[model samples]
Structure formats: C-alpha cells, structure tokens
Target: MAQQARAVVTRAAIISGAAAVFQQRGYGSTSLADVCAEAGVTKGALYFHFDSKEALARAIIESQHELSSAIGRDLVASNMRGLNAMIVMTLEIADQLHNNPVVSAGVRLTIEAANFASPVDAPYLDWMKAAEVFLRRGQVEGDITETVEVCSAAHFLISGFTGVQVVSDVLTRREDIQQRLVEMWHMLLPGLVPTDRLADLLTLPERIRASRQAALGQH
Candidate 1:
C-alpha cells in the first residue's frame, strides 16, 4: 500500500513536470528527455507509467478538467443553475487560466492538439454539454429568452469564450481576462435575458468577485 501511494505521487510529479515543459516549449518542441529531466525521473520510470508524449499531454489536459470539474461539482451540489452558474463557471475558469500553470499548459496543449494523431476532445464536449443544460434551465427559469436556441447558443458561447481567452492570453498573458469576461457578458446578456433582467445580471461578475473575497476573508 505504501509503495502504491509512492507510485501515485511519482506519477503526479511527472504529469506536473511535463505540463510545465509543455507550457514553455509547446507540444511539438517538447521531448521525452526534457520531461524526464523536469520530472526528476529516469527513462525506465517514465516508460513504466506512460508510453509516449501524447499520453502525458492527455493526462495534463485531464488534470486541467479535474480542477475545473471540482469547482463545477461544488456548484452542482449547491443547486446553482442558469446564467448564474454559467457566469461563475467561466469566471472560475478565467481565474484558473491566470493562476494555474497546469491549466494554462492544458489549454496550450489543447490548442496544439493537431500534433497528436487523435486529439482528446471529451473535455471540450463535456463543457459544451454542461452549457446546453444550463441554458435550457435558464429558459425554464425565465432567465433566458424563449426565442434563443439552447444548443446553438451553447455552442457559440463556448466558442466565443475560447476566442476571448486566446486573445487575452496573446495580448495580455490573461492579465485582463476577468475584465474581458465582464465585457463579453455585457454584450451577450442583452440578447439572452429579459430587458428587465439585464441590469441585475450586468453586475453579476462584480458581485461574484466580492462574494469570493468575502468568503476567503472569513477563512
């Protein structure tokens, strides 16, 4: 049991090391030797756990999702839904992109997924699926317009966020992502929410930030 625990720790270390390398060198340029050096593991040890660089990249992407899903899981437990859930999820993701190296690397690897013969797309699909669910619930709750097509809106919102973050990463290294997300919601919410509801949701981002700060301070 002790040995198995050590093996688990070693595997996590390797994944984290590879993520750091991938973040800096990107997928095409990163090599197994570099990963081994970064991870402080021998080739034999790495091979015991993973056969190829693609496997390691996939693991990194999976790790990133695990982090985000933990946040989503908590929100789910709280029964949060609709635009409130979507806004909080996106805000949390933006914070992760700015603060977490593994997540940042995961996004970078995902973008460079063409390097892999078959890219892992389950994470993206899963997020879009969740968005669809939230949008449908929003319509039922009267937070979303009946005229909106839930599936199409879900897809566009997910893709639009991708573009927003990618542009933020390029232009500001994501320093301004929170503000950018606020701008995004401002432009998009009017079409989704009732005119009466628009004013309240417009300030949701700021309220969410303040709530987080208060929660942290209490701890």
Candidate 2:
C-alpha cells in the first residue's frame, strides 16, 4: 500500500513537472532529459511512469480534459444553465489561468500545440462537442433560441475564450477587457436567447463586477 501511494505521488510529480517544462519550452524543444531534470526523477523513473514524451503529452491532454469535464459538471449542477453558465465558467477558467501556475502553463502549452497535427486536439474537440451538447439542451429547455446554430456559437465562444487567454498575459487593462467581453456576450447572446426572456436573461459585466467587488469589500 505504501509503495502504491508513493508510486502515485511520483507519477503526479513527474507529470506536473513535465507540464511546467513543456509550457516554458515548446514540446519539440522539450526533451525527456529536461522533464527528468525538472521532475527530479531518474530517466528510468520517467520511463516507468511514461514510456515516451509523446505518451506523457497524451497523458497531459487527458488530465486537462478530465479537469475540464469535472468543472463543467459542477457548473451545470449549480442551477446555472446555457449561456450564463458558459460565460461564468469561462470567466472562472480565465481566473484560473491567471491564478494557477500549472493550469495556466498547461493551457498555454496545449494552445500552442493546437495548430499542429497532434492528439492534443482530442481534449478540445471533446470540449467543443460538450459545449454543443449544452447548447442543444438549452434550446430544449427554452433557454436558448430556436434559431440556434450550435457549431457556430460553440466556435465563437471557444475562440473568444482562447483569445482572452492569449491576450490576458500581455494586457495591462485585463479588467477592462474582461468587462468588455462580458458586455459583448450580453449584446451577442440575446440573438441566441429566447426572445421572451432575452432582457431578463442578460446581465451586464459591469454590474456583475460591481456586485463582486462590493461583496469582496465587505470581507
């Protein structure tokens, strides 16, 4: 039992270290020796945990997908639905990107490898498909518009979230940009929300930010 626990910890440590190194250096530029050095594990240890760098990369992809799926399930279970949940979840993801070192680095690394033909696409492809499923559900529940174009809306949201992350690191006015994006979602989402509740459904980013700040200030 002790040996099994130690093995799990060692594997996690290696994977985390590999992710950090890959995030700092592109996958192609990163070598097994680098991962081993960062992981503080012997080459044999790394090979025992993962047969090859490609295999490790694949594990990273699966790890990210599982993390994303867990978050999605939690968001949906919280009585949040449709576009509202998406926007909130995406903002939370952005917040995580800003806050979590491993997650931010892993996200950046995964995105950088996104253009290449690799298994890294599997996670995001599954993510987009999940988003589409959510959209379809929203339509059925009368939260989304009947005119919904699932694929296009899903792409737009994904691209918008990706764009926000790409610029988040460089932008000095991240708060303002995030505000603008929430506003943009409000403006655009009406076209996708049911007409009867469109006005009731939309919430301004500024308002949400103000409320968030107020609540935080209370603490």
Candidate 3:
C-alpha cells in the first residue's frame, strides 16, 4: 500500500515537472532529459510512468481535460443559467492559463500536438461538446437567440477563445487573458445573446473573476 501511494506521488511529480518543461519549451523543443532535470527524477523513474515524451504529453492533455470537464459539470449542476455558465467557464479557463502551469502546458501542447508528432483532437472535441451543451441549454432558456446554431457557435467560441489566448500569451504571457476574454464576450454576445439579456450577461466576466478569486481564497 505504501509503495503504491509512493508510486502515485512520484508519477504526479513527474507529470507536473514535465508540464513545466513543456510549458516553457513546447513539446518539439523539449526532451526527456529536460523533463527529468525539471522533475528532479531520473530517466528510469520517468520511463516507469511515461514511456516517451508523446506519452507524457498525452497524459497531460488527459489530465487537463478532466479538470476542465469537472468545472463544466459543477457549473451545470449548480443550475446556473447556461449562457452565464459558459461565460464563467471561459473566464475560469483563462484563469487556469494564467495561474496553473499544468493547464497552461496542456493547452500549449494540445495546440502544438501535430508538431510533436502526437496529434490529439480529443481535447478540442471535448471542449466544443461542452460548449454546445451550454449553448443549447441557453437557447432553450431564451438567453441565447433561437437563431443561434449551437454546434457552430460552440466551434466559434472555442476558436475565438483559442485565438485570444494565443495572442494574449504572446503579448503579455497571459497576464491580461481575463480582460481579453471579457472583451471577447462583449463583442460576441451582441449576436448570440438576446437583447433583453445583454445588459445582465455583460457583467458575467467580472462576476466570474470575483467568484474565482473568492474560491481560491478559501483554499
């Protein structure tokens, strides 16, 4: 039992270390030795948990997806208005990009996956599916216009958010990501949200930020 627990800890440490390295150097530029050095683990230890850099990256992507899915599930379970939940989820992801190295690296790796020779479309698909669910619910609830196409809107939202984060990362290392997301929603909501709900929904980005901060403080 002790050995199993220790192994779990070691694997987690290796993943975290690999994430930091991947975040800094990207998958193509990073090497197993880099991961080992970053993780303070030997090559043997890394191999025990992950066979190769591609495997390591895949694990990171899976972990990231799990965390993101959990957040979406929580928001859905809270009975929050779907459009509002979508806004909050977007902001939450931006916060993760800013504050969480694992998430940041996971996103970076997923984007550059083809370059690493380990193309992963699962994360993108998962995010789009989650967005589609929220948008469909929002439409039913009258927050989103009936004219809105949920799947296409989901694709658009994910693409737009991805672009915004990439630009923000290049410009400010994601320090300004939250603000950029707010601006993005401000521009997008005009088309997707009903006119009657626009004013209230516009405040969602700030509210999400405040709520995230409060939650962080509790921990």
The lDDT-based order of candidates, best leading, equals 3, 1, 2
TM-score of each: 0.93, 0.79, 0.92
2 or 3, which is superior by lDDT?
Answer: 3
| Model 1 lowest lDDT segment of ten | 70-79
For model 2, residues 113-174, the per-residue Cα lDDT tens digits are 65555636654665576677678778887888878899988877777767766775667424
RMSD (CA, angstroms), candidate 2: 3.4
**Candidate 3, lDDT over the whole model:** 0.87
- In model 2, the runs with Cα more than 4 Å from the true position are 114-117, 170-184, 194-199, 204-219
* Candidate 1 C-alpha lDDT tens digits along 83-177: 78888888888889888999999988888897688877766777788788788878888889889988888888888888899999999999888
Off by over 4 Å in 1: 217-219
Which digits, one per residue and each the tens of the lDDT, describe model 3 over residues 1-219?
999998899899999999999998888899999998988889999999998888999999888878877887787777888888899888888878788888899888888887666468876777788898899889888989999988899999999999999999999999888888888988998999888888988777777777877998999
Error of 1 at 151 (Å): 0.5
For all candidates in order, the CA lDDT equals 0.86, 0.71, 0.87
Pairs with steric clashes in candidate 2: none
**Candidate that would win on TM-score:** 1
Q: After aligning candidate 1 to the native by TM-score, how far in Å is the CA of 212 from where it should be?
A: 2.4
* TM-score of model 1 (CA atoms): 0.93
